[model samples]
Target: MAKKDYYKILNLSRDASQTDVKKSYRRFARKYHPDVNPGDDIAVQRFKEVKEAYEVLSNPHLRDQYDTYGRTDLDSGDVSHGTTYGGADSVEVNNDVFETDVDSDIYEVSTGEDPYSQPGGGPEPGSDLSFELTINFENAVYGAEREINVPTFRICEACSGSGSAPGTKTAECKTCQGTGQVFERDRYSGEMSLVQCKACYGRGKIIQTPCMRCNGNGSFQTYEKILIKIPPGVDNGSRLRIHGKGTPGVRGGPPGDLYIVIKIKDHEIFERHGNEILCEAFITFPQAVFGTEIEVPTLDGTAKMKIPPETQPGTIFRLRGKGIVDMHTGARGDQHVKISIVVPKNLSERQRGLLYKYARTTGEL
Candidate 1:
């Protein structure tokens, strides 16, 4: 079957930029995420397709491979094809981008087709992977570098991802006579149907001595440590891309990317909206009655704001340029401090008399 074009799946042009790909993914994922479309099988399936398309299109290496080869076979990095493996291709929209049931689509399959064969030395692009990184609110505001260990696949160093032992080579598969697929002639319909050759798993070749390190799969699981930088003004759900840090590509293909999904912890005193911050401040009756300058907490540092005389509770004061920095533009937002008047809990006799006297003087007792 032919593979679905990832650019079409993401509603993108062949020349779309990385930023465009990201924007499209976010817009589509929000509409089709399982949480947004509960119990809808079609929506669930579409969401998965959208995710798969994004996984391929968002990464530079993978997108290039998918474009050049017309397939996204990251595993074992087989880049020697210009046509999709099977005639089994599907539609543009509402297509199943991730062909999990068909291993030949995502991985190597034995083939007699020389044009599609991946020689022992060609670079196979790696699969793109995602990780969710939880960070403190302050770190998101101030920006910080963090080290993380990602559990993913890397090309086998021992076999160099060829699936054969060192100094050895793969032999042509015999089941399909070097053809990666088998054909059956139906008498009644007079139809010829093609099926993947199981002998060499459609690779049209067999590795007599598989690499012991990777067991012929050409990749292994390991944890990789990477340092990622968090940009200032990043809030929860911000996504950052780390190129060439994901699953390693096949044979000698370039590594895939690691997408970092940000999750900022809730702050104790402040809540963020876009680049702005909202916080609550408490002032005594005297402070509100006589206009005073008070220190207010900001993401940067303490800032002084004036409370006008006769200030009312629930009034919001704007502290310009004291909120989070704009991630893209580098501009700053204002901080909104909501005022809450604090009344004395326990009144002494002298305090109660003073308040009454003061109220009477103001003609409000």
Candidate 2:
């Protein structure tokens, strides 16, 4: 069977940006979601297809593989006729066994079939998983480790993923006589083709007794606790990749990856913009008039900042290299302090007199 064009499925062009892909996927997903179109098999199938397309296109590695090889199964040996081992002439050698030498390796060729073509049983890559993690502001700035529980699927432990009960055996499929295939004739063209047997689903065997734990499904769902390392300088919307920590593979295929989307909690005193930190400090009128030092809060505790003489209200001071560290470049950012002048609401008579005298001397009263 021909592979579906993912771009078409998403109603996008091949050059569509990642943002475009995401937008289209969300639109299609909402329209065809199972809850929205309950009892509609066609809508359910469309939703599944859209989800599959999004999964492949949203990943850079998988998207690149799909673009280059026209498929995302990176480990599969199947290729186009021109790229096959025996070249164009090898297309007709489906049932013929031939030896080919490439890079000092000899491979025996057989009928061209997808490694995962069998629906009943075959090695299939696991689906990638995503989760959102919210960390403290300090943790986002300086790195921390956390433990989280993720619910996912795993191979059944009772029957060791065999789908058979303990001390039980399987029987050959009677539909195809253990061949796992049956001949089907096309109604219009009257052409015959060998297709997978529906009874055994191409596994050629049936479990006489199903495993009580997994119900002969070969896998089960459970919650797994995992320890994750969060790097420094992770801001809101930051993504971290954890390899082989997603859903377990099927039939011994490789497991998918886990993606953690980071959300930084808002700080009580500090506000972040990119790598820079913004904070406010209030000073008395005298302190702003005559230079004075004040303590300012920082990630490493309070630090002293000098208030220059005649500093205007809303004046900003920069403390170099006191902000967050860039995770990619390893460079530090600066912290900015905005100074605000405060006037005493309740003042002693002597203080008020001194202030009036100062204002008169400065010609401001």
Candidate 3:
């Protein structure tokens, strides 16, 4: 049998610093932790090897003895040149090993003091909530107030969020003896580690009687009506944030935020391009040939615009300060009107005669 190299196991050199050793250990531990790779035999073996390597390299005295004699075992009394090293003593792991909660991205480490063992437990912030809302195109351009119903979880009022009936008290968890943690020995590695207590879920205390209304859950689902103000010039895919409007927190922690994703409806008469407005207006052939005044739709109301003589079809005219207002700069944009010529389908006998005489004069008859 041969001894494994501690430095090689951690992917470090013998001259690596203590900080570097600890950093590599945390990275490997997170990758091979039992909770992260459940039921994987290969990962479990790698985790045990990483732990053993860290235990020897983290201690200064053990590292010096290994460097000199190439072995850390002192119980055999095989000393070179009558040198004496420290006898076998239990090694205390100062650096913490972490267990991750994938859903919440929370890390539970072996820190001596358990947060849930405190008087009122710990304050955990609520999770943020998001919702999508659709608004009218006019409302998005000019802005308006909208009321929406959001269904979410709220703290129960029956037992005041305690999860217990009135006058009933909570008792200490016997499984962990109120310490919120328990020591367990690994069957394969024969190493002991502290893990969160499953009985009380690391809460040190357990409710004696469950709440009748909430069924022992601290919160209940309900619909909340909230009035939100939409800012002007908001386009589709705009997001609005409301503070402290999400789910209720635990143990007096702050509530999360509420997010509203905006979706704008299509308009029949007008189209928006950034802060600018675009619209098409139909004009008679005579009106386009000779100058005339026409009415066009705008954000405020209808506005009159003048067309010049000899104007061609598809000519564009601009009306200043008739478009949407800029939300941030407070500046207004221009409205563009595209001209389209309309030809009469039916012509009277007298009108046809006059048109034939005009065509003869122009040498087109």
Candidate 4:
């Protein structure tokens, strides 16, 4: 096979930073990992290529050699001193292939560059936020609108998130030449790598005069009151999404999304399974003996059900379309009611006499 360009294989520029290399490696590895793309020959081959590229590019000495002499340095060159490259397919040596101090089981761990870093100017998207919302069972069955307070970062109105004091200007970061990144050579291996400039916090500019209210942070933490519309048929552990309601992004990036996790409180009268509702209703002995109509509680309102003659206890009756509705299909599930016979505990004198007389007439007069 012809030699592949390590940078091209990783989709990185020649001057990409160590963090960018690691981040790209993680992204490509995760997408093409054998476990993720099971039984796919192409993915398997691509995963091998990514791992090989990362192993070579991640090491300072090896990367420097590869940059100067290309892949030929692995065979024989001035840059091949302590660097080693395995076969075209796999990690051949038993020693550590990665020298970045990251986990050896790279696939199991999340290793990437700062998600908030923006390469082409502007800020990266804010991190996604999660909030658990506890709601009543009725609200979960029938939709409800609830007002909630979420703690998050909001843009600093004092300086409009620019971090500079009013009437002051931002100066270009000299350390990174307005790129927000600095290149440094390793002391031992003399290899070059990119790192975020500490002075600008990767902003490519410096706030000469810090904002007094936000202290140059560009945002502050405060409570935001938002009305969340809970849809019907949402169960416990269900998640509702509200876009652009999360933390304020850095610089001019778009805000992140807010995820509302539903925690349905237990109901006193009903137990829900998927879209179906289950409950138990007690009927009098006379009602069970002779056919009678009884009222049962449903999510909507009271529903009348007919109890058949000689109906035994523990008989389950289903009322169609009386349960929760499906969120996607709009189809409703059935409400199942289990029957319980309630026998009379105490009898009046007339009632006892009537029962005794009836028994005597039937057999032992």
- Model 1 regions lying over 4 Å from their true place: 1-123, 152-154, 166-209, 356-365
- Please identify model 4 stretches exceeding 4 Å from their true place: 1-122, 157-210, 350-365
Candidate 1 is scored at a TM of 0.58
> What TM-score does prediction 4 earn?
0.56
In terms of lDDT, the poorest run of 10 residues in model 1 is 103-112
* Residue pairs that clash (backbone atoms under 3 angstroms), model 3: none
Cα lDDT, model 2, residue 287 = 94
| C-alpha lDDT score of every prediction, in listed order | 0.69, 0.72, 0.69, 0.71
* Cα distance off (Å), candidate 1, residue 187: 28
Instruction: Give residue 140's lDDT in candidate 3 (0 to 100).
Output: 72
Using lDDT, give the best candidate's number.
Answer: 2
Clashing pairs in 4: none
Clashes of 4: 0
Best-to-worst ranking by TM-score: 1, 2, 4, 3
Model 2 residue 322 distance off true place after TM-score fit, in angstroms = 0.6
Kindly list the per-residue Cα lDDT of model 3 for residues 1-365, writing each as its tens digit: 25678889899865454556787899999999999999999999999999988987765445544543346775343434444442112211112221122111111111112232333366655544656667777777776566667766788788777778877888888998877778989899999987778887676778899988898777898878776566666667554545556667666776654556667777898888878889999998878878899988887889999999988999989999888776544588889999999887789999889878988999997
lDDT of 2: 0.72
Model 4 is weakest, by summed lDDT over 10 consecutive residues, at 102-111
Error of 4 at 314 (Å): 1.8
